[model samples]
Target: MNGMTDAIALALAAVLMAGAPLVLATLGETLTEKAGIINLSLDGSILLAAMAAFAVSATFDSPWLGVAAGMAVGAAMAGALGVIGIYLGQSQLAVGFILTLLARDLAYFLGHGFSRQPGPDLGVWTIPGLGEVALIGPVFGPIFGSRSPVVHLSLAAIFLCWWWMYRTEGGIRLRAVGESPRAAFGRGIRVRLVRLCYCLAGGALVGMAGAAYSLAVKPGWGRPQGCEGAGWIVLAIVIFGGWHPVRAALGAFFFAALQVSGIYLQDIFPSIPAPVFQVAPFPMMILTLLAANLGRAGRVQDMIRRHPFLKRLSQGWSIDPPAALGQDFDPRKGL
Candidate 1:
């Protein structure tokens, strides 16, 4: 019993650490989407940022500098998306797809020299008193108390984003722009500027996530960077989470749990091919996404409406995308 408890605790800790990058990336995309922009270059952006972060850190021997470099790269990529897609009225999907391919190749070519290289490590920091508490500390301490600053940042971002979106004036305006740019413009909001700002901010967060991968989570730079498909996963998680910061974060952790389980399952069933375990999570997450959306079915809606308790539960589970997502807004045209 004690051994099982210990194993579970360790697993939880691993999940938190492993999920931090995903959490940041998901939140970033959620913010961008909430502003009516879709930065689909996440996969490539993360890869490029990871390479830049690792290269910079290895060169300067400073993780902080590496993080900054990663953010710059991410913002640059996002800014391009905003300028071309949002301002110039190009197809967001096409521009983003091209940028992703460009960034991926850039990362591979530029980062080739730095592959498998050592970089400055961002070590862990344990809170002073949390682990010393009497009854619960023994269990919760390792799970939450001791962790890298990146993990703490990821945790803090969840609540901070939730508060910004639900409890602040700016958040209200941002949501308004996403729902209807014309409506937001009539109400005196700077629709284009707001969208652009949020897009850059979101991109910065995504870049930081890339830094977290090379500096903390995976701890090296290499081809097949082990995070190849992470950006797409982050994008899906944002949709699965209904564009809510907290729920999106939960989705990240859930995916992380799936990854950790894959490792354990490999040991339990050695006959199964390793690639099968690795690819399983993607399909499983897609299924979960389908299940989550079932609440939108007419019959499900009717059943929930018939019961007050179920209706209330359904309200929390329902998915709602911003009405103007992926559309361009032109201030000159009064739209």
Candidate 2:
């Protein structure tokens, strides 16, 4: 019985740890895409944040400070994307993909030298008295009957994103801008500024999420092990969430569960190809995109009809991205 309790605790921790990165990045992506600007650069943004956070934490010898530095870099990266898409009028998807390449290489170069260096790992903080229990050890216990601090933070973020995306006046205007930029502009919303702000804010959160990967999830920073494919999983989560914060959060949990379970399964079945879990989110992404397409089949089919190659593909699956995903909205287009 005691052994079973311990196993369950370890499994729970593993699950939460695996899902932590996804939760952070996907939640942030949900907010950004909700604004109609898909950040293809989150791959890069997260990498940059990981390196910067690790380096800064090492330099300052403070995990908290390091987390802050990481978030700043992430936000800065998103701001760059905003400048290109909002001011320079480049392709959002293209530019984002380009930056992902840039971010990866940059992180590689910078992180190479620091691979073996030591940095502080974030320890779990629990309540005082409750941490002392018979069956519950320090790593797993009643501890005032709660989970890791990051879990609480993630929950708070879910509500915050929901409020900002739905309840607030600003959120309404943001949705308006995303659905139809020209209409949003006509309604006296400063479309460019609003979008830019959303991009930067989203980027900042992504950076923190990436930092969480190293600072919390992985706990120790190394080049290969940190921020591995997390950015894309986050993108899938946004699509899975239908650009809603709460739903996207659930998507994060689902992906996270698969991830933790995948890791656990390794002990039980080492022969199973690791790539299966690594690649699981992508297929799930396709499914979500198809589902969203089903919601807007008319427009999706029309677009597919316009594209010779896509028309055949559309017959098999739903094909919508989001209400306004990935399209460069020009006021002149009047959409």
Predicted model with the maximum TM-score:
1
Q: Which stretches of candidate 2 lie over 4 Å from their true place?
A: 1-9, 128-148, 271-322, 329-335
Lowest lDDT 10-mer window, candidate 2? 313-322
lDDT of 2 by residue, 202-306 (tens): 888899887887788776666585567778878877766767777777778777776666666667777878877666756766676567557455876678788
RMSD of each: 1.2, 6.6
- Number of clashing pairs per prediction, in order: 0, 1
CA displacement after TM-score superposition, residue 217 of candidate 2 (Å): 1.1
- Which of the numbered candidates is closest to the native, going by highest lDDT? 1
Can you write out model 1's per-residue Cα lDDT over 1-335, one digit (the tens) per residue?
A: 86887898899989999899999999999999999999999999999999999999999999989999998898889999999998899999999989989999999999999998777867787888887899988888878887987889999999999999999999998899999999999989999999999999999999999999988998889988988999999988998899999999999999999999999999999999999999999999999998888888999889989999998986886578999999988888754
Give candidate 2's whole-model lDDT: 0.75
User: Lowest-scoring 10 consecutive residues by lDDT in candidate 1?
Assistant: 311-320
Candidate 1 C-alpha error for residue 211, in Å? 0.6
- Return the lDDT, model 2, position 235: 80
